[model samples]
Target: MNSQKCYALLIEKPKTFEESERYCETIGGTLVSFSSENEFKILKGRHSKKKFWIGLKQVNEDWEWMDTTAIVYSQWKERNVTRDVFKDQKCMFVSGTGDWHRENCEKKLYFLCKFNRMRLT
Candidate 1:
């Protein structure tokens, strides 16, 4: 009954961010990628305005989404001035429609993963 985008990446039940990331791998994908505005919109909200996970990370104080998709545009949320605020805090989650959430590399949450149907041979 949640009003969020349904994704095949996340397990049916809610899982931690670490668990979700690993789960995505099992399905031959990663915790989703949203480099385009359209893909970002697909994961706009939850029923109660909670944040979900995306496949991004911080390294050497730079914030980036999963390497799967090239970043077409960036619409950093108003409260996201803390990107790379921590040294080892890698991996990312995005919610709040256009904003991003960064957590520890091991933080857990339901994630949106994606995979190409076929290998690019």
Candidate 2:
């Protein structure tokens, strides 16, 4: 649990959703997800009313979290998993309320990045 300070990164640029996701991975965070009320509050308070890019991707038009590497858990802005317009898209974002939404992976948006405990490997 002793991880280095993980700063929430805000990326406001026009890039593919995949690109955004990859950018966070490169830095250490994997897009922001509201898994708990506290986390939701923290991110919400920190970001206020801005939307940011996340690391969720749509495979075969289905939404999934790239961080979890599984489908059992969902951490997104929207409850509905299917997006007609975003089906082909492969990136997600965090709305002001800490909800997830599918948008153009290449669209410009503020982003939230997370830094986890450095791996011991």
Candidate 3:
């Protein structure tokens, strides 16, 4: 496996969750997913003050990432109230304040793509 670090691209144009996912795939990546708090903080610092879709969505009764990683860490705006509010809003996004919120998957919004390119050893 390639040991190169994952990188991200912030797409300014707004798109629905599916649209954003397709766009990222065309460029050989997937929507961004947070694997750790430090990674999230680093990206949050660079992409602060902007709302962007992340690779998280509810599937059945559980939320998961586009990359198929198990959902671990989350930055929900209101952790206590999210479960009730997330009934209809299945997709997750990072708000301008770097807090996460759920919304309709069809709602248009900017998105971030995560990728790891191969490197010659």
Candidate 4:
């Protein structure tokens, strides 16, 4: 049997980043956060072929998880860096191809939430 403690739930319904965060709280979990490159890769592979939001988001000029953890690992896809400095909030998500992408918080998309198995079970 698997001995891991963390687990993920992929909410298939599309919702804005804020809405998704609230929903995860309702379920007693938070949007997924990665602790390492291997964890990110494994989770991304497990949920391949679909775009989904993770817990990472841009705060001013730095990206951080919803729980305020500094990002120690990342696998970002190459994209244009141009942005309107005053426009909207930027959120990050895992692409179907398993790389991180930054998007506006107002955009609707599926999201993954993480919960501790010890508390859940």
Candidate 5:
């Protein structure tokens, strides 16, 4: 039996980032935030071949977690960097290949939600 706790929820519907965040909140979770390689691996394993929104976005010229968590890990894909590009591409999503990409927030895409798992007594 699997005893590992899973607090992530993958919503495979297309929705804007803001809309997705609201949906997560309504379900008692927030947009999923990956803080380590293990967490990323777990998420990737669960949602293979699917691109989804994560809890990351650009804030004040720097990347920040929308859930206000510390930015401890990142897996951004190598690409040309430009101020104009970053300015327009504010939100982020994980690709099916497990790489991160900056995208416009208004772009509709699937999303993942995260919450604290309660231990069963």
Candidate 6:
């Protein structure tokens, strides 16, 4: 089994969500998805005070990862109030403090991408 882990790449340049997604794909990766608080913390520890795009988006009133994987975890801020305001805000981004927030997908921002490490075998 390929037990290699995945790692993230923080592209400092600002780009719209669609552009960012394409960029990651060109490099053999997809936008970063956080499945646990630990993964979020590690990302937070690496980046400084900057907003970065993640892999979460609202589709038909449901939140889903860009890769179409089940959303097993979330770190959304103002969770209770977000549902009401999320109608116009479909794309998700991570704040400096590691909390998640919704934004327009057209807004350009730094983005995070995840690629699996290849086994050296």
Between 3 and 5, whose lDDT is larger? Answer: 3
Runs of candidate 6 exceeding 4 Å displacement: 1-3, 81-84
Residue 29 of model 1 has an lDDT of 75
State which candidate has the highest TM-score: 3
At residue 60, give the lDDT of candidate 6: 82
The worst-scoring run of ten residues by lDDT in candidate 2 lies at 1-10
State the lDDT of candidate 2 residue by residue for 41-61, as single tens digits. 665676677877766677675
Instruction: Judging by lDDT against the true structure, name the best candidate.
Output: 3
Clashes of each: 9, 12, 0, 0, 0, 0
Taking all chains together, the TM-score of candidate 6 against the true structure is 0.86
TM-score per candidate, chains pooled: 0.64, 0.67, 0.87, 0.82, 0.86, 0.86
Q: RMSD (Cα, Å) of candidate 5?
A: 2.9
Worst 10 residues of 4 by lDDT: 78-87
Worst 10 residues of 5 by lDDT: 1-10
Give the per-residue lDDT of model 1 (tens digit) for 3-30.
Answer: 2333553436667667777777777777
**Candidate 1 stretches greater than 4 Å from native:** 1-16, 45-50, 78-85, 96-98, 118-121
Candidate 3 TM-score to native: 0.87
Q: Report lDDT (CA) for all predictions.
A: 0.59, 0.63, 0.84, 0.77, 0.81, 0.80
Scanning candidate 3 in windows of ten residues, the lowest lDDT window is 1-10
What's model 1's lDDT at 120?
42
TM-score quality measure for candidate 4: 0.82
What ranges in model 3 sit over 4 Å off?
1-3, 80-84
lDDT of 3 by residue, 15-116 (tens): 999999999999899998887888898888887888889999888887889999877788988666347656889899999998998899999998988888
Which lDDT value does model 5 have at 30? 85
lDDT of 5 by residue, 1-121 (tens): 1133246555657899999889988988888887788888877888888888998988777888888989888888847534685778888899999999989999999998887676779
- In candidate 2, how many clashes are counted? 12
